[model samples]
Target: MSFINFEILATSIVILCRVVIISLERLFPYNAHQSLLRKGFWNDLGMYTLVQSFVLSQIIFGFAYWLDGITELSSYGLLSSWPIWGQVLLSLVVHDFYIYWFHRWQHHNRYLWRTHEAHHSTEDVDWLSGPRSHSLEILINQTVEFAPLILLGCAPETIAIKGMLDAVWGMYIHSNINIRSGVLQYVINGPEMHRWHHAIDHEAHNMNFGTKFAIWDWIFGTAFFPSGRKPVGYGLGDENFPENYFKQHAWAFRRFRKK
Candidate 1:
């Protein structure tokens, strides 16, 4: 398959997985109210995913094309050299590890945090919430997160596969479904762990920054879990900003100027 074709397929799979899982959660209310199926849910999903994904994909693909020339890089070439599934697993693991620290840095660095705070502004958690990030932030985060794969000589195909895996996993964990993973939450960052990261609690604000895996949080001693308590709420406090996407983007820069 061609590179574009593969990307299309990958994108479709990720979208379908999110829709199916979330739909199921709503249809079969593991948590009495079936909140995931509420009105405006799919609307939010469509707008959030379509707008953000379209823009980010274009920017990332452009960068990938540029990098491919300077380095003669292709994720496919790297994967073709190894067993197919092995390449996928390696890409997933490495990408997750890179994202863990990259995400942490976004919180630790004030400038980056300004860009990242748009994501946390949402007062609720849902599948669509995963994509509601600043375009600039998306561009920066994706570039840094993918740079390692390129520099390590991974094929373009391998990188694409990794991107698909990461996208699906991110959407899954951010969805509002109440499915619990129990102990696996410690090893992998699932919905339960991720929801807490979005919690309004000050202590939860900067904790659990890992993208796909919780191993990094555990290793770094940044992980937090309170027994018998879920986050009381979600979103940033004391920095109320307009919900208009462009306005939020501008707010980040304004805050940047003041600091």
Candidate 2:
């Protein structure tokens, strides 16, 4: 199929996944009081999710095209012989592993945390909340994500499929649905573990760094799962965090305050 058609299909699947996840949140909400139209909903949806995503996707792909031009990497067809499913799986696992370490590093390093703080700034983290990330954060992560797929000669369709996987999994891990994954929670990352990563409680700091897989946290001893309890609140817990999209992006650039 053509790249345009594949993109259209991937986008439709993401929308459908959002609808289903939202429905599940209504039925089995982990935080039942959290509203669908929570505070900063429009800024998160209209500006961060839709507008930023469209612009960044274009820039990321453009960069990928430019890089391919310079290196002519795609001409080597490095991964062309792999089945489409294998290529998708390879991208998912490799990037998930990379992100696991990088995400942990972001929590520890003060400078990197600036670019990441806006993501954890949301008091209400729903499916939509997953996309309320700083543009720099998305730009960096997505560039790392799609660049290799393009350069390695994966089919153009692999990009759309991997992109869909990322969207759906990100929303799932951040959705407020009260999941009961039980043993599967050990292997796959979900809101059960990830929601606490956003918790304002001191105990949750720097834990649950895995994105699509929980194995990294388990192996690295960063997992935090307190049974029969929920986080008291989410976000940075500072009253000064900006709600405006432009301000939130700019907030990341502020000088470090003296302790």
Candidate 3:
């Protein structure tokens, strides 16, 4: 199948999941305050549409193609010829490892934090919230995530499958309708741990930077999971953060908020 076909299939799955999960969230929720029309609905919808749009995918693919032409993926990387599944497994580990550092710096570094602040401004963590990110940040993230896969010469099929899995896992982690994943929580990233990463509390701050696996946090000693308690809230407690998409986009540059 072509990239377009993969995108269409991914889109259909995402839309279906959103509808199903939203319905379930209304009937049962991890937080009783969960609402179908909660805050930032439109803003998040815009972000989701932008990320899932063909334009974004084309840009990503274009960049990958150019990079591959220069780098010319050789049969060297550890994952180069291992089965597709093995390539995907190693690709994920490598990609997540790269993002882990980037994500951590987005919190620790002042300037990077500004670019990433829009995402954290979300008071509510839901399926849509996963995509409510600054466009530049999204570009950087995709670069780090896919650069390794292309460089490793991973098959296109493996890349597509991994991308779909990543999207589904992202939606799952951000969904409001939550359920613990038992021991899997130690392996797979889930809401139970992810929520704490969004916590307004100091202890939860600057921790749990893993995008898919929790092992990175464990290895780095940055993991924060306080059992029996959920994040009472989210965001940086900055009332200055704009709620609209355009304002949020300009926020990193417009230091002077016009009255």
lDDT of 3 by residue, 1-259 (tens): 7777876887688778778877766666877786767788876776555544445667876898788788776445646667978887877788788888999999898789877888888887777677777777877888777767777777777778777777677877777776867777777787777777878998888889888898888778988878787787887799988887878888888664458
lDDT by candidate, in order shown: 0.73, 0.92, 0.77
Judging by lDDT, tell me the better candidate of 2 and 3: 2
Off by over 4 Å in 3: 1-8, 51-53, 74-80, 255-259
lDDT of 1: 0.73
- Cα RMSD (Å) between model 3 and the true structure? 3.3
Q: Over the full model, what C-alpha lDDT does candidate 3 score relative to the true structure?
A: 0.77
The count of backbone overlaps in candidate 1 is 9
Ranking by lDDT: 2, 3, 1
- List runs of model 2 lying over 4 Å from the truth: none
Candidate 1, position 114, lDDT: 85
RMSD for all candidates, in order, please: 3.4, 1.0, 3.3
